[model samples]
Target: MGTFASHRLKNIRTLSNQVSLNGYKEPSQSHPCEKDRISELPDDLIHHILTFLSTREAARTSAQSHWSVNKWTFLECIKLDIDWFHLDREKFCNFVDKLLLSRDNVNSPIDTFQLSSHAIDRASTWLDLAIKLNVKVLKFSEDRRWEPFYLDPNLVVFSSQYLKTLDLSNAVLDAIIFDQLNNACPALENLMLSDCLMEVQQISSSSMKNLNLIGCSFIKDLSICSPNLVSLRIKDQRMGNSSSKNSYLVFGTITLIDASNVEIMELSAIDSMFTFVEQDGSSPMFRNLRSFRLGPWCIDDNFLPLRRFLQHSPMLEMLFLKLSVTTSEPPSTDGETRQERSSTAIGWLRSEASRPLITLWPREKPLPPPPSEATIAAATA
Candidate 1:
């Protein structure tokens, strides 16, 4: 086992050497002083290269190689990708236990700790150690080939006040995660969730500055309430059975309350959350939104929801529309042909682009007083 672990670590120096090649210089007659590019790398990169090594291998390398003495002992990032080395669960667990114990002896604060593995059912102690170490950025992802890791909300309260970034992928999130978010990582500014399973209907955060959601859905119940968020990106793609299209109708509302300071936003494939108008036709506002991106349904009435978004964002300067030429949903253009309706919408968009005023475009189709759900859904569909 130790021999195989050492073999796994043999390539760390090679990888680091590759990264350092840009700085490497062949011995030249003009430049007398030979540059040791590998030694010039920042400690963070060096530590990352060393992450694959077990403690024993790291000690041997430090003793016999050109590495700095005891530098691995002070690594700020603890990234364990057990699957990458073909390490078994028991051996991986034992290695981590010893490594963390040795790290506890050093009592150094961790800047980042990422774990990618399938043996995380007993990962609480590892996470707790990260919190104790005051890790600032933590990324934990489970192997998709195994059972999903259920993230316990109770264990999330990262006692570390310095924790600023948290990324969780391929896990099952509890609804209570939102309830304990503020307390879990009070100073958290960036939160990224990708390919997770959850029924979290609403995600509310006041301190978070950037929030990214990528393909995170099980029942499509998702909303957001973040007043201090500066940048937001959501790429919603259903990750379940392809035969079930009903599960794909998981667009939730964006509780755009107290969100007058958002500067950048991207809503791909799920723009309905932000542009959705209730039966009464009331919609929220984005007073300070400066840049916006949207993914259009590309079917009939798609421009209707877009109209609402432009109307709400008074400060929008850069508008990016990802025009999809194809969509599975049928057109709902009433009697007007797709070409005619598309021409009208495109012309209106052109006219609006030329105008500086944030006013409504000219009424085309006898505009209803309050567009009903059927109407909004048709447009947003």
Candidate 2:
């Protein structure tokens, strides 16, 4: 023990002598404590110094640091991608548990909390904790193709009073989500759902302002009742498929039960327009509607849907028609090519000075002929 102590002293003395020979000043008594003491400084001061550190250098601090306070806690934005666990449920839960538990005392509210959909059962627990922490924007992403995680009904009952945006991908949701949001998340205004499936057919939300749906399917006929909704956009994710249908989106009925106030609406699907109707079969006046975008399906259906909208939405201002190079499944059998059919839709839109101005764009590279001079004015006549 004495020999070992002597060796350590000799090495220190040699280092000191080398510093002296190099004209370097010897470190003071506080020099040894400066490294750890810097971390004890004000958070803002320490954060500024930390900004100069490279990501690799910063990562070193995470080593053996899980138990350390003020590390992963106090985060304003928390995004947990569970793929790192490789489906190890125990580790995933443990990681999320520790991360959220550490934030129990954080004063700042979480701005966004994102979790991957692959986090199977315990997702509810993590989500509940995030909502309890006053998460403002909650999002979930798809990890497994088309696999959905249930938004626990119990969790939804007390989700968030401050949530403003709910963005979900590859999630299995139902009308319960919308029905329950009114009381628990009164502030939610924008709802974006993609690659998801609805177990039920009806969704009713009174407060949504903007709704976006992409590549979504429903088990039965679909109905939406959002009286306060302003902007509604539904896009067909499967655009170029030869089949007349989108496998990701299967619905027989699409009814806007109470969207009379919607101003800007865009529908891109195989049959969304033709199937669109009010539940009462009466034309509910979209008195505030200003802009409407339609896809190729309207022309394939002989402009029946277009006619319905033009007649019902008296205040409709601008119309947009997006045509794919090829028509989707159950090819139009009226002996009229899609190009010919579109000219009729466009010709009527062009001839009418009182009707909404129609803007046309093909999904393909080639452009079609100019609007036919032989106008099918019957559409808007």
lDDT on C-alpha atoms for all candidate structures: 0.61, 0.65
Best by lDDT: 2
Model 2 lDDT per residue over 64-135, tens place? 122264543555677776664566667667767766777766654677889874646777777777788888
Per-candidate count of clashing residue pairs (backbone under 3 Å): 0, 3
TM-score of each: 0.67, 0.73
- Lowest summed lDDT window (length 10), candidate 2: 56-65
How does model 1 fare in lDDT? 0.61
lDDT of 1 by residue, 272-321 (tens): 44543332343346767766656543223657777776777776655555
Q: Which stretches of candidate 2 lie over 4 Å from their true place?
A: 1-34, 43-67, 83-90, 105-108, 117-119, 154-158, 239-248, 271-284, 327-333, 363-381
Which predicted model would earn the best TM-score? Answer: 2
